[model samples]
Target: MTARALATTCAATACAATALSLLLTSCGIIPGLGGGDAPAEDPAPSAAPDAAAAHRELPLTRQGRMFIDGGGDVLLEITFRKLQHNGEYLMIEVDHDLLEPLRASGTSTDRTAPIRLLDPVTGEVLRAIKDPGTGLSLGTYFTEGSDVTPVHQGIPTTFRRYFPAPSHDAGHLTFTGSGLGHVPGLPVEYVDEFTPSPEPNIHDYFNEYAEKTADELPGELFYPEEVPEPGLDASAFRQGIESFVDTAESSTTRSGDRETISLHADRMFDVNADEPTAEAAETIRRTALTLRENPGPGEITVVGHTDGSGSDAHNRELSLRRAEAVRDLLAEELGEDFTLTAEGRGSEEPVAEEGGEDDEQARARNRRVEFVFTVPDTAAGAGGEGLDSAARHVAAPAVFFEDLEPVATAEHGDVELNVYPLVRDGAYLFQMVGFGNSTLSDLEADLGAGEEVAGGPDRVTEGTLGGFRLLEPDGPTRYVVRLVTEDGYEDFADEVLTLSPGDEYLALAVFPAPGPDVASMTLHAGAFGEIPDVPIR
Candidate 1:
């Protein structure tokens, strides 16, 4: 049968036992055989076949436990009724409904299904005799086998069998064993009653839990600190007053000598100086008129400042506004073509220190603005040739290998390769070719030969590749070379090269990349000949 059909069948079987219990309890009838009660033996058989057949076909009831071995390791214990039979076979019916939608007609009654058998003891399979045309079964027989044995003998046997059931099903099982007298050495047969529990929904549980847990927390508050009280210094206060008086006298003299006008006032400007102050406006107009009358290479810078009475942020904004006011006046008078820059130094670099009590006077000095002029270098007599003559020229390139030839030799221990770049007339020539070394001990040990040196074309740049050579020796030997820059370019080579005694070699040098972008470099090396037992250090 299909898996789904088998599962449904098992589910129905499990529910059958419970349904039977309820039904029997409702009818005031006992559903199971009483404990410690034995069935009475039948009288000796009669001679007539009809009488014997009647006796053998009598309805039988049994309760049994079931067991499965290799087929599947599961058990089922059940109680069932051996309903009716034909000839030597017995037909047993379970308490639960074992079939599901057996008839497509969908109107069949829910009834206990029959488990047909051949013989109760011999453990032989029974085949149903059916009409050739109708394909209807006459009766069924039980199969015989040695593997079958009685779960219980003499007394009514408890039948147990394990069957696949739906995921949430529950049930019990029942079957007959060889002790039923039909089969001599057969095992018990089984029946199962299964019922499935309703499936659970997860989302509903989660939402309910979340809502219950969300009802228990508090709020937040914030308060700012108070501003510090202002302090006054008597000595500093006197000094500031004196300084102001001195500045006023100096200003008067400077204004007179330069033929400029000056103004002293209780208030520098109107409440909102965002727009140009009258004096600033007049000054910007006069400056622009003068520039128009005599245009030349000169620039004007408008410096802005603010009082220390306010916070830094507020003072900065006020300073910027004051500078912008002057700029607007100049721009409007000069027709936007004038090259002018404005800067604000809010409460910084103060000319007069305020003593807190003279806050107004301190603010008056800080709030003032001024204009500075810068003449072009040509007019300043510098002629603009600053630092150009003192610059250094680029150095020429030099060949790194000068003392060391294309090929050289060294014994064990220290072999030094002297390398220097070649420079001609201010131009550098010939980048270092290549450098490498081999061990004599390695060759002698591995190839049974002393150290040997090999030179060939560079695989990357196709340039000539060469290195030092050392003959067989007992101890360690090494070779070193330094690369020199070509022309005005900087150059470098591998730091050092060392070779152990015996047979071994090493090649270390900078080479160009395989493709274009010759500016790129890389190092290459290898060991050959026999390596000595000395440590790599």
Candidate 2:
């Protein structure tokens, strides 16, 4: 059935608190919703029908499910109410209810989990507003004079938060918060203000006054009045979202119009030497090509970093020499069109932490070279080709697949992986996989743990499915999971957990859609190895 038809069925069934489970169960039939037509041979005998329910995507008015670890089988029912535009801020309202009693009351804090809005057109993630003076988020807080009402089981509690208004005139914004992962296609409504006050509307009073700086506004607006400050516009609070595209040779991070291309130092240098290695030629050539496509203000900054294994002084000097060496090669590639400057940071700005079981792995990641430059806004992803253009997109509503059966399966030890066919949506393609443990004991699968030489920079989080990527069936282009950099680098994907014995979990990963001429691609499933011939529908 079509999404519209599903919506009609949901409306008829009344997506209420009592019918939330029914809505989630019916979602399975919507082509790419969740668990669909089962395969003839069961690869994961422990897998069940509801393994992918946690990653279910639903409309704003409909009730969706969220799986909270250690909450047992009690799924949270989230109903998005509004993405209303206020005077200077955007207000988001949602009603949440716990399916069963677990001796815990839902608090407003759960609704404030790094709320962000995705601009599908510009590939920007809009963040919540914050108080510049106090450096505190301008949303619901559990401090004094605030509502600390506890949300009981089965009780629908309404919560609202304020955010920096979108700078564009888009009709809709994709809303993602805490467990309500990427509720795409949320209609944006313009209103003077929300009436009757949303529950835990701690800072709604800011709406009464005109947009002003902390000092310009009345002292009573703050908890402890201090020196008055100049008022600032909403534009000043805008935080740019960073987009990442990874290749075997280098990784590129695009923030706004600026791009930071990171190449592993190991790939460019031998041991602790400063000279260029044989593999450095390919990476340097790729970087030069990207710079030519998205030329900036004629100046590029090259920075170097190193692991914490060496002494501070030696590491700093070595990193500097390496940076200068790489910068020289890049200058030669770009000729006199760009002026490249080199600097070294040593271990001061390490991307990954040290002193752990994965310390060596983290050190390998930290040892890299970065080329930072600003690209013309028009030049960024201009032709919409290659991996860079494909990285900056979100999944849309497209359903051409007949069955959600696993087209490929890979087994490693007791862990089994079942990958479904790809679902092409707009400029993005969505892929789902079922991870099952055949053992009777509990399984702790860390998909991101890879021992190979680092391919690119990674986010700061651990135990995520960030290692998953897609390879062109017969081409050189590789696509990594789209990173949502609102708070930090988080995968623009959703997941369901398998914490019990004889259980299977389902997860999702989104990537830039390949060209229309391409029909299938190879999936790189971290520990499960590579699954080939995954059809795109």
Top candidate when judged by TM-score against the true structure: 2
Clashes of 1: 85
**In model 1, where is the ten-residue run with the lowest total lDDT?**
236-245
lDDT of candidate 2?
0.53
lDDT by residue (tens digit), candidate 1, 1-537: 001100011111111111111111111100122222233432212110121211112123322111111111111223343332222222333222211121111111112111212121111112222223333222110111111111111112211121121111111111212111011111223233222211322212322332331122011111111111122111110000000001220111011001111122113356535665556455455545544432242455666676666788876777777777776777777775667777777788454456656555555655555544432211111101211111111111111110112222223323322221211101011122222224333111121111221111111111111222111132112111112112221111111212223212211222111111111111112222222221100
All candidates' lDDT scores? 0.25, 0.53
- Residue 465 in model 1: lDDT: 18
lDDT of 2 at 138: 47
Top candidate by lDDT: 2
TM-score of each: 0.21, 0.58
lDDT of 2 by residue, 152-213 (tens): 34445454455667666555666544333334556677777544343323234433433433
